[model samples]
Every structure is written in C-alpha cells, then in structure tokens.
Target: MNDVSFLPHARLDDLIQLLLTQGFRVIGPRVRAGVIAYDTIDAATQLPWGWRDAQAPGRYRLEQTAGSRCFAWANGAQAIKPFLFAPREPLWQARRAAGCFEVQELVPPPRPLAFLGVRACDLAALAIHDRHFLGGLHPDPYYAARGEEMLLIAVNCTHPADTCFCAATGDGPQAAAGFDLALTELDDGFVAQAGSQEGRELMQALVLAPATPEQRAAASQAIGLAAAAQTRRLPAPERLRRLYQRLDHSRWEDVGARCLSCGNCTQVCPTCFCHREQDVPALEGEATVHERQWDSCFSAGHAWLHGYQVRPEIRQRYRQWLTHKLAGWQAQFGRSGCVGCGRCISWCPVGIDLTEEVEVLLAEAADGA
Candidate 1:
C-alpha cells in the first residue's frame, strides 16, 4: 500500500469543521474538577492541551506538559460505555388498561458519534464489544447501528498511564487497527494518517496534501517514542491462556479481601459489556417500563438464580471474571474479553491491578510440582 499522508496541519481544522457538518457531536478530553474527562468539546482548545496528567495508585493529577501536547492523559474516569450504552434506556413499555396489555418498543436516539482523541486501547475495547453485540447470534440493534456509524479519530498515546497494560495485550501504544484516522502529536502539527474510506474522504474534503518525507519520518518517530513510554507492561501473552486454564489458589483469597465487592473494576472496564434487565412501572400501574442496565460478574446479583446465588464467595466471583476475560471468552468468541485498557486496575478504589494478579496466578501455577 502507498504510504498515504494527507495535508498535515490543515487536516485538524478540517476535521473539526467536517464533523460539525456531518451532524456529529464532537467530544474529547477536557479539564474539569482537577482531572481530565471525555466531554462535549467545541474546538481543539477544549482538549487537555499542553498538559500531562500525573497518575499513580489512588492519585491522578494533571500537570502542565510540554508545548501543545494533545492526548497527554490516558483513560480517565469514564470509558466509552456510558455513551454507547446509555445508563438507562427503556427497553420497552407495556400498558395495561381494563385488564388489557399493550406493548410499545423503545428506540434510542441516534447521534452519529465522532470520537476524537480515542486511544488505541479504547479502539480495541470497541472491537471486543463488537464481537459480542454485533457478531453474536442475536445482535443488539441499538449498539450495532452506532458501532457501524461512529467515526474514530484515534490519538496514538504520546504518553501512557502507570496502570495501562495495552502493550502486553498487543493492543497498543500505537494504533495498528480499528481506526478511521490516527494521529501522533508533534511540536508544530499533528501527523495524520487515514485508515479507511471515511477518513480518506475527510482528508480530501479537508484538502490535505501529500505529506513531506520529513513529516512521515516524524510520525514514525513519534509512534516509536510512545511505544517506549508505556510505564507498565506485561512480559507474556501466550502464557495468559494457560494461566487461566489452571488458576492458582494462593493469590485468589488475598485479591478477594482487597476487592471491596464494589465492582468498580468491571464498571470501569472497557470491554465488560454485561447488562441486566429490569421492569419499571408507571404511576397507578397504567404503564410499565422495561430497561437494561450495565451489570458485572463481580456483583452479588450476577450469580443469583433459582432463589439462590451461585458464586456466593467473593473469591469465586473475582476468579470467574478474570478467567472469562483470559480463557473463557477465547473459547466462546475466539477473542479476549479484555482490551488491556487498564481501567479496571486504575479506577478500582482498592488499586487491585489485573496485570499483577495475572502474573501472580501464572507464577504460582508454574511453581506447582
């Protein structure tokens, strides 16, 4: 394939303008409440520009970074789930009048998303979700349409977080797949590369010219530097499969104790797409509401069935989740449920790191005579 480079600097402004015209509500990271979050951003200025965030266990603070640094922060408080799957949406409503029932289906609002500043890990998470919701036997019409239509303008991580482990999972510090456009922040301009037809059209619309040899070189160097800056990484990938197949007993109890049963890890995890359904009633029982909300295997309710809850032990629940992401998901979907975004590790109130936990399991498993 010919190395296609579009007009570098002009593409940024053009992308903004094009997205606006395309009826997409553009969103990216912005500074709020002393941290970075994904929010409705009008212009590039809304981005956490020139600011690098400091993240450690139980701490996240954004400090002023070098000149014009966009996407300097890794995944913050929220992943892409809330936007794709709304916190609450009426699944359908049933109305009863005079002992008669009528059913009404609910269709969610369609707002074509232009996810600016998406990281490679989030892109990978989207793919993971795509496997279940889109590629499954019963596809979710709600999620499928949005997934198919959303445009991703990925930001190659110029900086990664302390908890991030995408490198180990072969997801990225640099985007290799599942992006319409990929960007690497540079001193003067962003190195923009288009990966698909939509991106190519946008580039053409933006009137981006062929990149200079030096610009192409700069992009390559930027990707390399980002790949190296990953502060946390795992040594093995193939071994994870075996580790999951046979879990170690030693580390399991300690993790269960540290885990608050808060289920924050699963809530924050990018690829954890489980949800529970509920029926809600309107005033006077004239009408009823049915809804689907996000659920986690970590939760006590997840195992509830036949008037009893299985996996009642916190240890069992945690083990099941980790096992599924590594081994069970592969058996079912032929892919790992985890995107290696590190959201579970970073946002867990107790700082329960999945990478550390995985390593422990594998180490103990190997030692058993």
Candidate 2:
C-alpha cells in the first residue's frame, strides 16, 4: 500500500489530538529552561514554534525566528535516553512487616508514549540502546517493558548544526527505519510517510492528501543539503586500532588537564548506560529501598573495586571513556558506541572536541609507528 501523505502545517493539532485520543502520552519538542527539550504536550501550542537555537562547542542559545517552521533548529541537550533508561529509578523496596522483611519489586507502570520531532541521530542512539538492553545476552526487563510501548515520530533534519556529524557516521540527515512515521518538513507543510502499520492508521485520521512530486523533491533536496552542510567528521575508524597501543600517549594528559571530570558527556550521551545500584535504609534501619542511578566513568568512585581504585587518575578515566566509545565498544557490541550527535562537544564545559582528540591521537600514533 502507498505510505506517503501530506499534512499542512496548520493541521498539526489534529495529529496531536489523534495521539491523545488513542491513549498515547504524547511528548514533543518544547521550549523550556531557554532550550528545546522533549516534554509532555497536550496541544500544538506547547511545541517549540518559531524557535531556533544557535549551537557551538560549549555554547547554546535559543532565539525567535520569523519562519513558521516547527523544527528548524538542531537537537537540544536531552535525547530519548531519559525516557527509556531513567536517570534514577527505584528498583525494589524491603520493609519490616509480619515480624520479618517483605520485599517487593517496583516495575514502572507501562505507559504508551509517542515521541515527536525525534531526529535521525537520536533514533540511531535508540537503536543502539535496543541492541544492548534488549538484544544482549540477558535482556533488561525494565528497559524492555518501557521500550516496547514507545512510538517514534522522526523528523528529517533540514538545517544541520555546525557541530553535527551524523552524516560522517552514516546515521542521519534522514531516518531510514525504526520509526512509526517520518516527516520531512517543507515550507508549507510536512511530507509524511508511514514506516509501520500503526503509522499508516494514524495518517488516516489526519485526512492527509497525496504528496505531490514537488513536495517529495523538496523533502529530498532539504535532506541532501543538510548532509552536504556538515563540517565535523570523526577520524578514520581503522586508525583507532592503535588506540590501545597509545595507552601511554601524552594526549591523554593534555585532555585530562583541561577536563573537569564533571561527567556531563556521559549524562548527555544517549547510549552510555553505566549505572550503579544502591540500597537506602530508612531512619529506623528496618527498611531499605533499592535504587539504580546513572553512573559515569569520569567519576572517581567509578573505578572503586573492593578496597582499591583501579583508575585513580583523571587521565585514565578519560582514556577509558574515549577508547570505549570510539574503539573498545566495537569489540564488545559489534558497533561503535557513538552516533555522532555532538552532544559531547556542545555540553563540554571546556569545549573539548573528541573528534579533534581522536584525530590528533591517531596521527601521533601513525607518526610514532
């Protein structure tokens, strides 16, 4: 069956209403805390309308635009990670009851969610999470339960951010799959196409018209321009084979000197899933609550094992993060951990670019060899 449809810009409200009526807790891009972020939305007014952001290394500022575009800006700091793998969650609780301890696991209630304005790189990150949490040797029950109820509505990027390098990673400028519906925003409306059965059913409620050749061509041209516009590119992946060989490389010290070890990069990274579990006892010390919170290798406590800290130096911690993200992850996951969304670049307090570091490190390694 034909999967393409055209929805005029004014009719976006209908789409939101349809999702709400279908019992999906809809979340979309909204302006909050001076930036665009995914949040619960009940109407079209809650979206980041006519808002654009200027982004650079360690910089972000939102500004009003004259256009009617709903998603002209590049991504914000937040991604879909928080929605699936929560930052902090209660796993189970143990209480003193019936002259003994009673333990009950607290699984989050499954709520169907529809994510709007999801970008291609973000979508790729979600797929990578699926591989780890769902396709791993033993699937995580919590992630699996929450992930299955999600509906993804991807938006094709027309304006690429200066820091964006999804094209170099072959992850974006356009979403290829794993979405219920994909939209390419044009001047007047969106060229929408279904990627799943549910998406087709949702489009029927919008009463969308058949897309014209002009609209389809405009969509293709917009993404093409975005792809060609990217300037940031990672160092050759093949060169990273010498990454472990350069363990004692002096570059680690250079990056470590400026690195604050703030753990912001891992927090913003959509695919970094390191977490630590804790048990908190009540004031009476009779009851305890088991919780899991996101953890990062940048933290000093991350290397704590038994009575010894394996990686006590900040340089060692930073090296572990970069090497794992760019190289070691390939050995474990059969794919690189980075999706090239550039959040690590933009969110760094010191504005350190991993792309630059990798390039320099690889070049030095080649020269030394």
Q: Could you say which candidate leads in TM-score?
A: 2
Q: Give the Cα-based TM-score of candidate 1 against the true structure.
A: 0.92
Instruction: Give each model's whole-structure lDDT.
Output: 0.75, 0.89
Candidate that would win on lDDT: 2
Q: How do the predictions measure up, each by TM-score?
A: 0.92, 0.97
Say what the RMSD of model 2 is.
1.4
* Cα lDDT, model 1, residue 359: 72
- What would the per-residue lDDT of candidate 1 be over residues 1-369, giving only the tens digit for each residue? 233564444246567877988888887788888877788876766777678766666557778866566666777877676778665677788998678998987866667888888888888887777776777578887776555568888888867777776777788878888888887777666777888988888777776657778877887787677667666655354566775655556688988888878888778777887789999888796999999988889888899998999989888889989888787777777767776677777677777777778777777556442
Instruction: Point out where model 1 deviates above 4 Å.
Output: 1-3, 6-11, 235-237, 244-248, 367-369
Which residue segments of model 2 deviate by more than 4 Å? 365-369
Task: For model 1, state the Cα shift of residue 208 in Å.
Answer: 1.9
Candidate 2 — what's its lDDT? Answer: 0.89
Q: How close to the true structure is residue 307 of candidate 1, measured as C-alpha lDDT?
A: 92
For all candidates, the clash counts are 3, 0
